[model samples]
Target chain A: MNTHLVEPEIVMAYRDGQLAAGEAAGVRAHLETCAECQEIAASLDDVSAQMRAWTVEEPSPQLAWRVAGRAGKPKGKFWWWHWPTAALVTAVLVVAVLPWKRPPAPTVQTGWLPVGSVRTSESNLPLPPAEPRRHDSVAEIGPQAQARTGQLGGVIGGIVSATPMAAPPTSVQRRTQAQFAMEARRGAAIPVPTAPMIARDATLNLTVKDFASVRDVVERIVRVHRGFAQNLALTYQAGRNNLTATLRIPDPELDRTLADLRYLGKVDQEAQNGEDLQAQHVDLAARIANSRVAEARLKELLANRTGKLSDVVEAENELSRVREDIERMQAQISSMENRVEFATVNLRISDTPPVPAPSSVWRGLSEAGRNGLTILGEGLMGVATWLLEYLPTLIVIVLVFFFPVRWLWRKLQARPAFRLPN
Target chain B: MDLTGSDESLMLEVKQGSEPAFIALFERYARPIHGYFRRRMGDPQRAEDLAQETFLALLKGARRYERRALFRTYLYAIAMNLLSAERRRAAKDRGSTTDEPATSADPDAVLWVRRAVEQLDDQQREVLLLREYEQLSYEEIAGLLNVPVNTVRSRLFRARMAMKELLVTR
Candidate 1:
């Protein structure tokens, strides 16, 4: 036997039967002769013995019966229920949030004229009060003229009374006696030629290849059709040009002029309207004739002087009112005739360079890929910025609530269901 | 009464819907399974519950059983998983560690031994207990714990040495 003792680990390993056959034999030979090694081995065994001495209590008899009863029976299916429950919860959340996600309705404003005010034409009506009208030259006409046009027309031909007749006029009785004397001098005058009036207007939206060429072409078309451009505006911006022009063409040549303009570009939109003003013109002509008759009668009454001073003053006032009415009717009649002769055309022209075709599929795909990567990078950067912006709030929330939540969790854990009964 | 067969054969019989074979396996392993849980847990009732849970797990998994390893290895793996789950539950519920001082029948020698074993680190304690009580070899302990045999040997040796020192000093 060797004189020196083996290491304690070797001794423990030998006792544990962990050593190989030859090493176990060597340890065994040393242990037979060496009391110290034997004692160390005995101590290791003694530790195991002491640990093994702790008694293991038998499980209650009910456990075996319960487990046996469960045998040959299929286990309850738990995972099968989880999927449907998750889907139901998701559906409930979506339903609860749906209404809050909807956008709000826009507000609308409608402007109406005050009652008792009279308007002669549709153009005289005011726009909605919420939005101020844009100052376009074609729409503006003239501010002063527009204001005057909005007022009610004066009484005509005694058909519409300006004011209630208070009493029988002394001027009218004197005018009748004087008119009988004047009738012997001259007969009544006849009216001039009248025609059916129709106002023609059109709106066009055009996309043109060359803006400058289109303007020249439009001017040539108007000249050929014996028309004049009312308002011509050209705006240049960022490689694109926008043209807005209002032109007045001869009514007889309107169709030919519009066709020639359409040939200059692609017409994206067009609208035409013709309004008949024959009844309005006829009414005005009749009113003017009646007013002329009244004026002539009043002038005869003033010239005769068969009445008192009050009658003479009344007659002069009547004559002036009649003259003003006739003048207004005459002006309206002239304007109506001009509108019937000319057709108003509103044109909006946009000139933009055509988009270049893609060079090849590979180049197109590569461009698309580059754009996608740029968008992705921007999105990631936005997310990072948002997180950094809210980081302070997150930290404060964690600091304020972490310890209290942990303490409450601990307190709850200390309660009955968590801890075993003492 | 004729129950002399390998654990795999008995498990195979249980898989085939043989209730008698299942009962035989239960009778054979009930004590060791109960003792395993009893040594690890402080409360006897909880140990009993864990032992029953282990058997229940075995029964549930029997339909899909394959003869890959020894039935004892399969049984211990299930027991280990259940033990981990129970420890987690106890920790979450009680806010204390699972290896509390156990109430033994003999409080003098057994209590001292239990206290000394509990004082060791979790890995060393498990290795030592599996070796001493379960009588598993180093290779078996390595297989059960998913470590090398050398690690199991070293851990067991160190655990024994520490236990001896603790017992002697006290």
Candidate 2:
């Protein structure tokens, strides 16, 4: 009657038939005598009996069709998510291969370079000796340009002006000759300021059929005439398209650049003008000289200062202000000289359909549909390209992993939870 | 088709495309697997679908089925996978939160017992259910839950004592 109470764990184990026979006998003896152990045993059995109350019937047959065909693709609910895997792989292939199959985008050249920057120092170049002499302010630099080409065709600016600029350099070789002649005469006495120091510029408006081809031609002409685009803008719209080019051409090359530009399309309008910047150039030069003299005087004071600290500071500030003025005026003169050196041409080429049929809503909708179809066609092509390029590779990759994965899965599937080393 | 063969042997026959053999295994385990899902899921229709999914998984993976272990284990493994997936989906549908399985609508005593079982700690509750209803041995549960056998034993002990205490109070 004095057996100790059985532990709940042993009681449960005995109930579960897990205890050894000897342990079960001992627990049974304790249960027979001990009211507490007997209750624990009864409770253990009662728990199982209670759990048995929550019974469920067999499921209906509706779920039979879901697995009717090869697992019905699983709705990708499982870990594999087969459909998502396929979609992801397809997307990856599309991203990887489409660019190679798609046609290249249009290439439009842009950016600018310095004007007549061919010479580091123009005065250092060899001159075309005594090239020409003329009276009026004409294309003297232009004649020098044409003389090098040996064409002497006609007056570039106006007849009986300065040197008569002959004709367009017939060939690349002739243009090279002109460049060399300019390189030479640029040697000395190239009074870009007094070479009439005229800032010559032109504006040409043209309508062209092929904007791309004409743009290429315009680029070529600028290269030939030793010019560069200062700024160029293009508006490629559906109903209208235009290219505005602000070019900087050496004054001597202005005529040739204009001639080449003229041939791009039918000229809608053309105008050329020369602003005499001689007065401004002279004024800038005089002011700069005066500022430089003042700067030198201040420099002397700064170098050998014999004054109070505040006076020295004031003088130093004054000298700095004077030097700033000098540099500003010098920059203005340099800019003026450069303007005379490179004339600015504002040219616009447009492909706007002239006075034609008005657009209708129906036409717009038709255009939209056509655009959609075009996009869809390209998308399909991208998909097809991806399939052609990667499907085989993907299949090979899947094949590579399928057997081993299947083996491992079967290994896992077989055990279900029975044999573990630990 | 030997309908009365061992589970593994029947599964082998099922793998070999024996229709009668599959029907045999289905009849044998259908209620158990359905109960497995039914105990954890609130919806009977959902439980049915998961049960169907487990069998379908078996049918689909039959070719890959090997005889390295018992057929019931493999079948239960598939049922466990479907249950886990169903739980995840339910959790997501519930704003990404999860609660214990619901108490059944059985009669008064049965409902009390079910509530006490549901109120058990998750691992202990699961261990008790597996041991009690599914009749999985402690070692089988340890392997299924990927824990040591001692853990399964202690959890079962704690679960039974707690279930007894709960049943007494109610």
Candidate 3:
């Protein structure tokens, strides 16, 4: 074996000046006798010299002119550096810095999930009542009515004997009733003999890949569970989709619904809250009794003709007020009961898909076209929206302030480029 | 010892709108940069064009330059990129043809050296040039090219060995 070929790398080390002093001396001794290694060193030197020969032409004189011209332009001259350029500078600074300053977007985890109810329908057993009011219904009524009315409920039944107003006319009554019902529905002060409920509240944020499919499944689930979607919003984009929904599921099915929702994707967030309204139910029951007693007293005053006209008028007014109060209270009780019967579930579904880079020219063109249109539309819409929102202010400024500013600017521009310092 | 500071001070003076400082930097680096391109390109006109571009680039990029690394390294890095880009464009224009046979007057020693140098691979060629012509230390070359010192050593060694073999064969 050729000794030099045995370790060509050693020759390299020698060339690199990495050889120890002793090693270098030995290499040098070998080199004095060996023509091959010497030739290698010479070749290395020639190669280095050849590599240094790669140079380029001077850029055009026009290039210097272009850069200098751009730098010297009135518009470009320390544009953001002048006090007068504050607004422009702010814009430039934001444009320059914002991209780098922006924090990376939070990564979204998403998957395909069923649109339907996650839980099976369960009985909406009525919730226990909330705390009772301090005053019992019968206790608030006058003693005289208490003796004659056979309970306030019966006494109220007999008063206002003048055709009993026939529950008012449907059109007039419907609106008032609707209003009353709305109040009752919202207030939960009146009791409708609704089924006993197990009230529950659940919040779930999950990821889903197919928003449309999930939405469909959710709707089906709501139907199967005998629940309703109170409010829902779905947003779709090319690479992402999301759905936020408020569902009123039967209280008994809430737990099951939550469990099923978990199957959709990794539950990023979840929460639940519940309260029993049983005591409130009992308190409302007592208030209805007392209102009935007040009605009885007023009816007696109207029917007996034992008091003066003024007294009778006062009594009738009092009776009307009592009955109205009773109706309002009942509406509130009903609303409360309904809420207790239904469990509210706020579900947030996120569909995050990996953004596949456009590979082909056609895809790129299409994407570019879409992006162009979007940017164009967004720009137009942004301008339109800004104009719409601030048009009045802008108009006022143009009339009251901007016209003068413009006139001043024109006057300033008319001045010599080299102006005397103020 | 303070090569970076010297280069930076020169550049700083230039950025302060000093024409002379810029001219000085140009004069100092001109031949080196010219030789750099001249060795690679067969056509003198093209090499001259690239050299001018290097100086102009240095001028325009003066204010933007950061002194995090050696100024020479930075300048050469820019020059290298420009050269590579030009070569790519030329290659593309010529329908991706590489290795057109050199037809130069010095069919003697210079031609022989060019052939032997060209025989080495790209990394080998770069390592040879950086060490022998630029006189960069192994560490400096490694840092400039963003490679390990050992890699630079090995490449340089391979280049020398290859050139040796090629020259001897001739």
Query: DockQ of each model against the real complex?
Result: 0.25, 0.20, 0.18
lDDT string for model 1 (A1-422, tens) is 55565877788889988889999999999889888888889999899888878877666767765564444232333222233343445545554554532222222212322212211221222211121222222232344423322332231101111222222111111123234234423533323335556788999887776565566556644643456788899997776788899998767667766665664466789999998888887788788778888888999999999999999999999988997887677667666766767789998878756567679999899989999999999999989966675556555545555566556545533332111111
lDDT tens digits, residue span A360-395, model 2: 888878888999999999999989977886788667
TM-score for chain A in each prediction: 0.40, 0.40, 0.39
Higher-ranked by lDDT: 1 or 2: 1
- Predicted candidate 3 versus true structure: per-residue lDDT over A1-422, tens digit per residue: 66674255566677768677998888877878888878766666664555345333443334333333323212222343223345444444544454432223223324433332221122112212222223222122244323323332322221111112112111111123466556543543344334433356889998765455676556544543446788889887666788899997656556655664665566789999876666666677678778777777778778998979999888888988987888877776656655665678999888767778889999999999999999999899989966675566445534554455556545544433221111
- The C-alpha local distance difference test score for the whole of candidate 2 amounts to 0.65
lDDT of 1 by residue, B138-159 (tens): 8778888999988988898889
Instruction: State which candidate has the highest TM-score.
Output: 1
Off by over 4 Å in 2: A1-7, A19-36, A63-422, B95-105
The TM-score of candidate 3 is 0.36
- Native-to-model Cα distance after best TM-score fit, residue B52 in candidate 2, in Å: 0.7
What would the TM-scores of all predictions be? 0.40, 0.39, 0.36
Q: Rank the candidates by TM-score, best first.
A: 1, 2, 3
**Order the candidates by DockQ, highest first — what do you get?**
1, 2, 3
